[model samples]
Target: MKWTPQDIETYLNAKEYVDTAVVPLLAVSVGGEMKQSAAGAEFITLLSGHLERQFTGRLLLLPPFTYLKSNYGENTIRDLREWEANLAKEECKHIFYLTSELDWRTQEGGLIGTVIWLPSIPLEHMNDSQKMAVVDSQVKQLLELFTQKWHENQ
Candidate 1:
């Protein structure tokens, strides 16, 4: 579910079943003029929309956490962990941070949850079929990750 009033109401009423929180980690360029970087951001948004639709009420999709790529550092990861703690209080046991940027390499001990980083696909120039194919593959991989987490928890 997304951050809408209707969805939030539904989520609150069904809080026990909504155990997962998916947060998209987006990196916005300084000026938002570079085409490739902008495309990555759009791809994250598109993929995130697909994720929300697939998981529906089981997943709470937060807005993209935007930051400058050049400024990515320990503090960013720290803030993400803090956000994870806040979400945990809301009863979300699994927090997934989805990103396309490869520069955010950090050790697992520092993070409070899982990070799913898929290569960015430039959908702006692709035909409709090509775009659909990429999204299909990405969703399949995400499902596998979610399944793995479910078993680990079990």
Candidate 2:
């Protein structure tokens, strides 16, 4: 199913906060013929804009790294772990993963696709409400963390 801005907002508003910090991660996939690089750039731009408008603090966007062909899942997990480590060094408090599926067009006009997101994170255990809550908290905590870190660094 397609995600909409309203969906994100609704989910965020409906979340219950625990003592844990949640980070927002987005995985986006686009059609192979659709210029994945450009799509990634656009997606980040849109996401950042949304954050700025809806949240009260600054948010940091990470650079996207391309996944290799072999053991993509394992690679994703490793990437996330490294990211977490780096953030930890910087005293970052939250981390979230977002994954997306994209369809690619081939010469035959058939669609090819890929799934991109951090690996090793389990989604099967989360109910719809729980997932929504996670998403909401992820966004919220990211902004919070960013602001907290920014001030500390200043």
Alpha-carbon local distance difference test for all models: 0.83, 0.40
Compared with the true structure, model 2 gives a TM-score of 0.36
Per-residue lDDT of model 1, residues 1-154, tens digit only:
9989999999999999988998888887756546767888878888888888999978999988887777778787778778888998877888888888876545355676788887888798788788877887899889988989978986
TM-score of each: 0.91, 0.36
Clash counts per candidate, in order, are 0, 9
Model 2 pairs whose backbones collide:
23-96, 25-98, 26-98, 27-98, 27-99, 27-100, 29-102, 31-103, 32-104
What candidate 1 gets wrong by more than 4 Å, as runs, is: 31-33
Write one digit per residue (lDDT tens) for candidate 2, span 1-154.
0134654464355433211122333343455623544444444434444454554222233444445323346556556567567655654444333333222111112201111232222334677677555545545754665556436545
Which candidate has the highest lDDT of all? 1
